[model samples]
Target: MIFAIIIGMSLATMIPRVIPAFIVDKLQFREWVNRWLNAIPYAALGALIFPGVTTVKPDEPHIGLIGGIVAIILAYIGLNVILVVIGAIAAVFLLSI
Candidate 1:
């Protein structure tokens, strides 16, 4: 029963992601639509990050703010995403300690 349930859960999670790539690949999008679609990841990242940026440290919100600023600056300077995240984490860690 547990094994079957795990397989069922995996299939349920996989289907949505797998079906979309197949469907999207067969469709033609306009230039503007493609541009909008490309921006989705950035938008999603910002949505996920902003809340944490503002409240990562409850007692001292400034650490999060500093880390967020470091991330933004690194990203704007064309650093890789991993580097930007590492810079943010480093800033927060150093400041918090």
Candidate 2:
């Protein structure tokens, strides 16, 4: 009974994830739809990161915002991603101290 329950739980978890991959591969989206879908990851990443940036120093939120701005400028300038991240971290650290 325990083994059966575990297998059932695995199937339930896997099905939703697996079905999308198969379906999306077989589907052709309109150009606008494709563009919208392509933007989702960046939107989601910003949503996830924005909150943390704001909360990095609750007493002085600007430190985080400045850090985020530094990161954005570095990225816009086409610095390597690692350098962008390091630059942001350095900005925050220097500002905090």
**TM-score of each prediction:** 0.61, 0.63
For model 1, the run of ten residues with the poorest summed lDDT: 45-54
lDDT tens per residue, model 2, 1-97: 9999999999999999899788988898999999999999999998988778878889888888899899999999999999999999999989877
* TM-score of candidate 1 relative to the true fold: 0.61
lDDT for every model?
A: 0.91, 0.92
Off by over 4 Å in 2: 1-19, 25-32
Instruction: State the local distance difference test value for candidate 1.
Output: 0.91
List of clashing residue pairs for candidate 1: none
TM-score between candidate 2 and the true structure: 0.63
Show model 1 residue runs off by greater than 4 Å. Answer: 1-9, 30-32, 58-61, 77-83
